[model samples]
Target: MPRVIVVEDSPTQAQHLGFILEEAGFEVVLAPDAETGFRRLNEEHFDVILSDLHLPGDSGFDLCRRLKADPVHRNIPIVVCTSEVDPVNVLRGLQAGADGFVTKQRPPAEILGCVRRVLQRGCAPEPSPSARTRVTFLDQDFELTAGREQLLDILVSAFEDVVHINAQYRQSAVALREANRKLEQRNLELQRSVESERRAHEERKRAESHLIQNEKMTSLGQLAAGVAHEINNPLAFVINNITLLRRDLGYLEAMLSLYREAIAPLAVGRPELVEPIEEYAEKVDLPYTLENLGRLLERTAEGAKRIRHIVASLRDFARLDEQELKEADLNTGIASTLDLARGRASELQVALETVLGPLPMVTCYPARINQVVLSLVTNALDACKPGGRVIIGTCVKEDGVEIAVTDTGTGIPPDVLGKIFDPFFTTKSQGKGTGLGLSISYGIVRSHGGTIAVESTSPGGTRIVVDLPIRPSPTAAP
Candidate 1:
């Protein structure tokens, strides 16, 4: 194997050259500068020296001149493997006595071929004095003292490489322009497709949103009416009981006034005066009045308490004062929802059953969860006909709590089941539903990082399960 020394200022380039030469069965020594290259040459006889034009201490051009000046090393071949491909650098390398000049851009095979050719010529005798020529290039004067044939060979080979590289660059430019045109055309088509789809999606969202708002208004009206009914019954009985108590008090007050006037004037004969008071008390039916008054007061108090309970349930369901997330009991929300829904359940003749199990406190928007419970239970009740049953239950789960609403009524059809959660989709008759209930509930659950799903068999019944994390995700919005 022929020994070659690679001198390159860049460590990476030196390694690359050394690897190529060694892979081709040459003994390669790497040098990071011209000084190192000379040091390596002194230690061992090298057949070829591959060097870059730029170096930290001494350049490749300087190395070429010094080597050619030395009598013993002058015969060694030097190849200037540089990235500088200009005519100026080529002339300078040749004038400095480089045996052959090759650009770093040349393929490995071409570089290897150049090196082999230079090695063969290094055995030839030095060029005669008459063979040297004085030449002027790029406005600089230079004498080419290297072998005439060898100089011409290196120059011609470099020129051919430059011409080949230019042709390749021209072809690459044309191909790149064509690729760019196709990419631009494809981008325009994709932009148009995306815009059209965007408009359609926005239109659908707007329509669904309008329907959802209308449904919300309808639900609000129904809730108001139901709450009013729940309040009015207790209020009416309370007023009636107060009226009866007032009339009995009036009779007793008149009898007491008559006894005071008659007994004060005749103290010794007050027994006869007491007879008139007794007769007046009998006319008023005082004993019956007293007995009924106590009952009326008790009934009035009970009615007042019922009214207060209805109001409290309404407050819980609305959660008007609470907006943000808080540690709340899901069971409490469920109970409140049931309290508000009991009236509707009674009217529908649907038996409302509960199977409440132990549940953990969940961090959530209490009002929204209450709304979810109400929506689910109301749907369950609506699904059932007379004598049907709706069961609402809650239990603890691994990471959270689950609420399940099961109803014994007509279940969803298989074809429509998948679309149930889709906005504005419903099985109810026209004007009966806006169909955003379950969709809204789904959104609420998703916002809480929870899941809600339904299980149903046609004509058998439907069970909707809602799983809520004990602690909602931080990103959850009220």
Candidate 2:
């Protein structure tokens, strides 16, 4: 029978939920608060947990969060039973990692339905072909098939051997059996342990990477600002020179035209004056010099424009602001990030393509979100070779917005896929990456009630997707 744990502070409420589950043919375990509920979970297996929003010590949301953080318990679907059904409360419950939420005022039938659905979905599946087969000496090598009595008799007889040998063998058998049994318990616990360790390691690495990247970016930003200032000075002079040169050319052209007109009349009236004017024109090389000067001014103007654009891009990239959540256009952020990545793209000779769809305005920190988009785009550019393409697209989903950045480059290895988002995890050469970009981005997206994931092919490239929830205003209905 499926086991269910009902955690509520009120004895009557707990009993009511337990009774409902018991009547539904479930084995029910009751706890008055989060502490006992969690203790029971660690001691035994339960298919699902029905938790009240308010407990004595820790709230239901906290319990759900703790459980989700533990891999071993994370998968046991938690249906939050709460009186608070406000949008903010529901959002908080989801963010805290509850699998489902049902109001405490809900009918018993509704509660039962919720419990049944959670249990059916949360139950662990049978071992498959690829599943690891645990081996234990007691179950694998020994034959205890006769009966429990026969097995006990065999054990007693076996113990009559050399004392040291019998003790060693029995100890080994017991240890192996215990290990196997522990391994066979609810997978959520094991998952929780592994995930917790992995996240801890990742967090440490991310902190280090963030420190390093910030240092590098700070230095680079200063250098860029200085260089831009220096270039602006020279460009100012160059542009001025072009303007002066253009004026000089215009004056020379006007003088030459006047000379041509004067010569046309002088040929008949003052032939001698025409010769002197022709001589003057030959000495100045007026035609060729004017043409060359015009071209020079044109090229100089183009160069100055290019420098101005680069300087503007650098200024925008270096300007950091405090984080604030507000309404933002995803397309506008992408555009800014693309401009900031121009230098990187130039170095890689990669092409960028964007196909943006209508997206609902999402509340977020613009600068931080821009940083994430830039990091992702820069990573994509670095991963690809010349002639490769990076495609960024955005669209609105039913629940929120989705942004995807895809690159046609050397794809990630399957073995390393899971670790890509881990901090300090990089496939790049030393000095090329700090590796905190994606990890930090992952955290940022999660903080906004969103998720970030990646997909990649063996020989193709990688695509990173980000999803953000649409937060409605308080006055809005459910």
Candidate 3:
């Protein structure tokens, strides 16, 4: 019987796995922690080892590393069984020499399947099918009676050789079957490669488009700022003239009012009053209009101020420089990114909330960091439906700062979640998104000696967390 070892901390979980393996017709051995697990391995050889990542003392990863480093146990295939299904966890498990990784949430059938495959591989030897078989024949027709007996013995020996040859032929046939299976697996891997390449090509195109859009926006912002400045210079004179004209009109109206008052008292006679009123109206045409010229001037000034404000916003959005490192406040960068993406939030009708914590000034490229924050926030907004909420929080940690952007939006699909950070991989409609935002953000954070990750639930929402170092290390460059 094939022997299988399971290393887990939980009694119920361990027993359940052991029962399943026993039901599968394998001799099962159980260890509750890494210490006992290592002892079990030293005491007996096992076909496969199923280990939980989180054990009592040593972690599954550490155990795997130790096992893989041991010459005696290195050939034993290890399957990591854990509740953690994050990409990082999966990656770390593989890095630690786990031959297979299966989440505890997976169906028992899947776990059994992995166990069977690993044990089958462990028990089987590599097949060599291509070697040719050799055949030799001997004839016994020499002596009469004694030669007849010799001929029979020779024939018997020939028969024995024939049986041996047949056994070798069967072994060769089994080897061929194994070779064919391996070929099919290779073909399947090739197909997956082709598919991955196709996706990569699509991603490249999306990245190009995203870069083009950024460039266009930058150009437009510069143009807008120049036009606003030019217009402001001419508008300043127009505003000044409008103000002076209103002031002169006010003085003229005041003088006319004084004249009217003086004339009203002096001209008690109807003929004199009529003549004075006609003369005043002819002098200034004050009764010809009732519009407030001062109000018009005020409205003009307000419009100009609004235009200037818009221009300033545009300038801030477009400001980009060569990647130069400097000390910067992360909170300021977050605020600016929010301002830049305000339009996107408005379109989605998503409310944005920020809880900024006290963070140390970090040396990083301000523009690049801003771009990263903007990309993350934009992605969060895009994921959300109308009336959804996005929360941006930041805090200082022991070695760095953590920024988290969370959204109450449609969660990521499980199948495509792993490829989210791959360039050009998008879940949006064609022409809607280029899908390079997260990839670029990931790159920027890495450049700053930081890490970025996502947590999400299907049909629920997603949260992106970024941890950045406070100071850029010269030797630890990204």
Give me the candidate number with maximum lDDT.
1
The parts of candidate 1 lying over 4 Å away from their true place are 1-293, 457-459
Ranking by TM-score: 2, 3, 1
Candidate 1, residues 1-478, lDDT tens digits: the string is 8999999888887787888888899999888889989988988999999989888988999999999888888889899987857778877887888888888777788888888888877833566878777889878988777665786777777886887689878989999999999999999999999999988885686567646644664476457557766777877776676777667766876776675667656656666766776688789897688678768767776767767677777767776557679998888788877988899999999999999998877899887788788888988988898999999999999889999999998888789889888777888899987787887788788889999999994568999999999998999975
Clashes of each: 0, 8, 1
TM-score of each: 0.47, 0.51, 0.50
Which candidate gets the maximum TM-score versus the true structure? Answer: 2
lDDT of 3 by residue, 161-195 (tens): 45545776798899999999999999999999999
What lDDT does the true structure give each of the candidates? 0.82, 0.74, 0.73
Ordered list by lDDT, greatest first: 1, 2, 3
* Model 1, residue pairs in steric clash: none
Give the Cα-based TM-score of candidate 3 against the true structure.
0.50
Candidate scoring better on TM-score of 2 and 3: 2
Q: Which residue pairs show collisions in model 2?
A: 70-192, 71-188, 71-191, 71-192, 72-188, 72-189, 72-192, 73-188
Q: How much is the lDDT of residue 34 in candidate 3?
A: 86
Query: Which ranges in model 3 have alpha carbons more than 4 Å from their true place?
Result: 1-160, 163-310, 321-323, 457-459, 475-478
